[model samples]
Target: MGKTTGFLEYDRIEESYLPVDKRLKNYKEFVIGINDSQAKIQGARCMDCGTPFCNNGCPVNNIIPDFNDLVYRQDWRAAIEVLHSTNNFPEFTGRICPAPCEAACTLGINDDPIGIKSIEHAIIDRAWEEGWVAPKPAEHKTGRKVAVVGAGPAGLAAAQQLARAGHDVTLFEKNDRVGGLLRYGIPDFKLEKSHIDRRVEQLKAEGVTIRTSVLVAGKDGLGKDSKVTNWANETVAPDALLADFDAVLLTGGSEQSRDLPVPGRELSGVHFAMEFLPQQNKVNAGDRLKGQIRADGKHVIVIGGGDTGSDCVGTSNRHGAQSVTQFELLPMPPEHENKPLVWPYWPIKLRTSSSHEEGCTREFAIATKEFIGEKGKLTGVKTVRLEWKDGKMSEVPGSEQILKADLVLLAMGFVSPVQSVLKAFGVDTDPRGNARASTDFSGGYATNVPKLFAAGDIRRGQSLVVWAIREGRQAARAVDEFLMGYSELPR
Candidate 1:
């Protein structure tokens, strides 16, 4: 531990945010990170519990206590090293991850948890400013080539690791820019695109070739109304990729958004969250969008209260929406968890995001019955109150109402990866429609198809970016071992 009584001596400090009025006027990041002194104080709060549940709580399994100690001692150089040892991109997680690590912090058992995420954020941002993050290209070539589909976190991490392992790696993305969901799905107010651009530069310097706007699949792979957003200008046949690469790894994320099929679903003002979110991101990236699905001056009703719904609320607020409300199907969780019972694990509790703080009316235990509109234009939403009994939900008698709305966004979670991609690769799928692959260290990440592997949401279903990075790095090790009978890469 940095201090013998650090946990008792210091309280947890949180990162600050810009005023709501100021941040709502723009589409830029607003969360202000802590300074060196604040970070040190937060690091000192680490108790260095014997079990170190924070490490396991983090999807990338970052060594929490060591970095906390390093930061506490002001050894920032070593701090970044320890931080990067496990997480390929701490900046990404530090910005958006809910920080399960904090929930599992031993200190959090009875008090506020150490601010591990903020410490990591400060460390990475400092490393970037100091030019400490440099690409380390391979010393020798393995004379083998690998194709990594989807230029998101998983694909990028795997490509970088494979390049460092001396394998020629090519990463493909259907979007015009890399960073899949990170590039398009997530709003700029959460994470700007420049972060992704910088990582792309490093990946290139490490001898990885990145190709954007290229779709890899056979004909009849994607269906009409599939809702898998694509900005591809070129399509490469699966056979062509198979013939060109020595091995293949699929990391394409789950893009099929879970949709609401209700009466008046085809109304003009009704749209998927993906359709609305990506347009704003594209506009922020300097793309000219005609007739954009905007929320300006509209009564926006966002369905399915989750992160995506929160994002829509933020984006809508930025667009000067007249009013915004969110609906959730499940009953509200407790404001605070029963820590004794859920320590060292993510708990079900109320999570009010920064967006919710800006402005939003959140209604839990409500279900949308239909999109009410006139002449094919959405005007309102018909909703009914729900009650949960014995773990089952039923409608409350005569508790139906119509909510005024000019626009409705379906923010429900994703269902599965686009089936065409899996069909093109002919990979087996688990019952949940994810790629079938075990994570057993001995033969992990490999699909039933020889020389083909899968990782990230495509293999594990919709998940956090940190988890995607872990799978990518581990899958790279698996690939290296398969190629040269050994690998020096860390898991």
Candidate 2:
């Protein structure tokens, strides 16, 4: 509402990226955020629509209009204030979130949506540069202890909120470092580790105790060769936490990677995206990884046409692969969605990520039939074309083919959280294997077990980071209300 005719006067300005050649040499963030003036112009494009669908569209329900107005008025400090009021970590979401808020923007019905994500990135980056982001430690300590398992965004948010609410919160992470997935799963080329480090320091300053490389599991303990990444040297029993902590929260990510069970899946070259991704992140963080999976000088085939697959393509390119190809089981979506029919909601459409643009041969409507290999090493992949009709898929006759693939990375999404953790806590789980819990205003996020709560992927399955933050904040409020009679923390 800062400028009524601004939408008509301004066109959307997209964030720029560093050249692929220059960026591929190193694992660092390449996104060039928009300048303040460009952000202001983008903010001006926010129409004064009576209904702010963007607010509802955003997982954390960020005050979009208020931030946009603040940016438009060149009030960077206030803009970040509004942004932080809702999102505990805007830097994370601003960099990686797909910006569902933009899809639901009123201006997007016909015109380009306002560059909300870019504005957010600019605001937060500016705030950090101006030293506006600092710790807000609780004024008084509550005589209660809380245990938060998993140091990902959800766990981080919950710990921050609970600590600010004057509770003694100890955040546990299975990995050697914090940031469950963000610390390892995501490539450093997309999000630098420094962001997570600073936030870790902020949490420490806020009086949240962080315990990394500590695994809290059931009596049996997490078995060997578990696909879930665990670098914990110390293992704490669930019973110990229940006895020491007044409340426990499970905010771990969905780490159960869906596998392709076709023949030759046992091939040495075939690996889960998680298996390959985390190694690179560790390497980027200066950890020495012997026999780390690399795509160098190999024909790489990444299965699954999702963000993870795109990430594989990018990483492969960075590894100097001979060739990179991506496969999608489903037919390609339309280049553009029908706005009239899908307004104010996420729509199905073709999305080409920066990784895809770098260099990738994308194959749609194709399924891998089998992995062809010799000497226990992958050599190629057999595939079949699919024809879809009425939501059903049938193989196309005589459409089989074999493609050279020295390394095959299965980038299909996660199915559920590691069951062992939930089992350790004696928490109930949904049919999908996610921890079963409700989001009702009263006793929300409470698991079947008393004094135990679940949020983020552990409860809702794999989702966007923004959704994880929302669940964490809401779960914190729920825990606060459970500890005290009521909670002043925002839900």
Candidate 3:
């Protein structure tokens, strides 16, 4: 608590964004971070709550009050150290995480929550500018080797931790570059790729070997026509890794996108959100793609009301689409949640992202009945209105309608990880198809197979990047203990 009365004296200051017109023309981060003074004011708003619910609210359990106090005191270097102590990559979460920590802030019960995410953004950016972020290589080699499959947040975190623990760690990625979904799934307008690049360099400096474009699979391999993105030029067998490395950790993402199997789903114009999103990201990265799915001059219909759907709307607007419409199967949530009933926890409420604000017509409680098309191409979508009562949904009589659409992007969330990869290593899986593992302190993250571990989306299903980092760190500790009979690495 830098200032006891600061919460009463300061109002929340939100981060600003570039003008929509100017930002729509390019794929770059548009958020204008708050200045140091504004960040200090925001930090000062952190109440000296006894419980510090914000810490528990954060997936990685960041020391929120400590960082807030540091930022309030203008201790930029210390602020970043505290941030990095919990989060391996604050830049990613600061940009994209929904900031549940703010929702659970003590001040939020009666007033606006402290702007923790903005303060974090300022701290990390300032640290980088001041050259405070640098490699902390291990003091001595442990003489052990570890193999981490997948180069996403979880894998990256695990590799960094294990390498810093003095173990030889090699991170394998199927894509030509690192960052599983972050590399290709998210639009650059939200998160720039340079952040991931610098971290990649840091990992190398820390003595973690990064092998991109390398697929580690079993005899079956990811099928030739798998929708999961793979750019691996070399394939390594699971057996080879088991023999070469002391332990193997699976941190791959949940790449199995849920599909709408309605009539005309086979239409050429209908595609998964993953199929359309990665292309634009690659193009933004200067990779020219022929026949890339574009929304230009077309009536675009994005099904699903989640973040992925919002991303489609933004990308479609950037592509200069004639019109962009988003559909949500569930009824719209309240504009505001009942704070008294849901305090100190994530509450359900309507969320309009920057992409939605840019331009999008959102339809809620609507379901697509069928895809209407001709000549093996999509033309329109048939829909029905829904009425919900007592947690059950029923179609409204005679509410069917046909919406004109040239491109239909299914932005529904993923169902599970690519089961093929889990099966390749003969690891047990939960009913949800995620790798089965426990998080108990005794041998946590260990799979049924000895010496094999799982974390992040591969183990817990699709989740926030912060959660991925937490799982990665804990999994690294588990692996360290398994290797050396005990570990000192923080979980």
Candidate 4:
């Protein structure tokens, strides 16, 4: 609304990236967001849509238009306030979230949408530079102790909110550091570790007790491939946590990666995306690893085409793999979406990430039939093309072929949280293996067990970081209400 004709006069200006040659040499964040002047112009492009679908599109329900107007008016301080009102970690989402808000932008119907994400990135970065980001310690103490089991987006958000609501929150992490997936799963190139470090300092300044390398449950409770990569110094039992804390919130993310059951999966050089990604993160953090999984000088094939797969592609390129190829079982999506049919909603369309643009061969409508290996090690993969008819896929006759590969990375996504953790806590789980909990406004997020609750990927399965933050904030409010019989914290 800052400029009624702004949309017509301006085209979307996206963030810039370093050239591939320079960026691939090191694992560091390379996205150069729009400057303040450019951000103001981008904000001016927000139209006065009677219904702001972008608000509903965002998982945290950010007041997009208000922030846009504020930025256009050059009120940078107020812009951050509006942003923080809904999103606890704009810096994280601004950097990593797939901006569904843009997809649901009304301006995107007939033209490019407002650069909302870039504006957010600019706003938060500016806020930090201007020293506006400070710890908000509670004025009063409620004397309630809460245990947040995971240090990912959800647990961090919940811990921050509960601490702000005058509760004594103790955040526990199995990893040596906070930030569950953000710390390890994501490559350093997309998100630098320094971002997480500053937030950890802020959390400590806010009176939240941060414990690292402490597993609430012993290692035996984890699934076979679900070993947390971080070094653990101690293990805390569930009974001790229940007895010590007034309430416990489970924010442990879905960690059980879906496995490829095809023959020869037990072969060497075959690993889960989690297994491969975390090692590189550890190495980036100055931890030298022996026998670390590397794609160097190997024909690397990454299964499952998604964010994790893209990450593998990027990392493999950085590792100087001989060749990199990605495979998607589903048919390739359309290059462009039918906007009229799917306006104001996330549409299914082909998304080519920066990793994809770097260098890799992508194969769609293909499935791995078997892992081809000799002498008990991976050598290649047998594959077959698929044909879809009547909403079902059938293997094409005589379509089987073996593709050369020396290393295979399974990025097929997670199935559920490790069942052992849920079993240890005795929390009920959904059929899909996620913690069972509701999102209703009344006493929601509470699990079947008394004083036990769940949030984020542990409750909702694998999802975007923005959604995890929303759930964490809401869960914190729920926990606060349970402890104090009422809460003023925003959901």
| Per-residue lDDT of 367 in model 3 | 94
TM-score of candidate 2 versus the correct structure, residues matched by position: 0.99
TM-score of 1: 0.99
Q: For model 1, how big is the CA root-mean-square deviation?
A: 0.9
Q: How good is model 3 by TM-score?
A: 0.99
Off by over 4 Å in 2: none
Question: Clashing pairs in model 1?
Answer: none
True-structure RMSD, every candidate: 0.9, 0.9, 0.9, 1.1
Regions more than 4 Å wrong, model 1: none
- For residues 220-248, what per-residue lDDT tens digits would candidate 3 score against the true structure? 67865357867888999988999999999
Residue range 100-186, candidate 1, lDDT tens digits: 999989889999999998999999999999999999999999999999999999999999999999999999998899998898889
Q: Per-residue lDDT for 1-491 in model 4, tens only?
A: 66888888888999999999999999999899999889989988999888999999999999999999999999999999999999989999999999999999999999999999999999999999999999999999999999999999999999999999999999999889889999989899998989889988898999999999988875474646464455777888888898999999999999888999999999998999999999999999999899999998999999999999999999999999999999999999999999999988889999999998889999999999999889999999999999988889999999999999999999999999988889888889999999999998898999998899999999999999999999999999999999999999997
Q: Rank the candidates by lDDT, best first.
A: 2, 3, 4, 1
Q: Which candidate, 2 or 4, has the higher lDDT?
A: 2
Quality of model 4 by C-alpha lDDT = 0.93
Q: In lDDT terms, how accurate is model 2? A: 0.94
Give the TM-score (vs. native) of candidate 4. 0.98
Alpha-carbon local distance difference test for all models:
0.91, 0.94, 0.93, 0.93
Lowest-lDDT window of 10 residues in candidate 4? 221-230
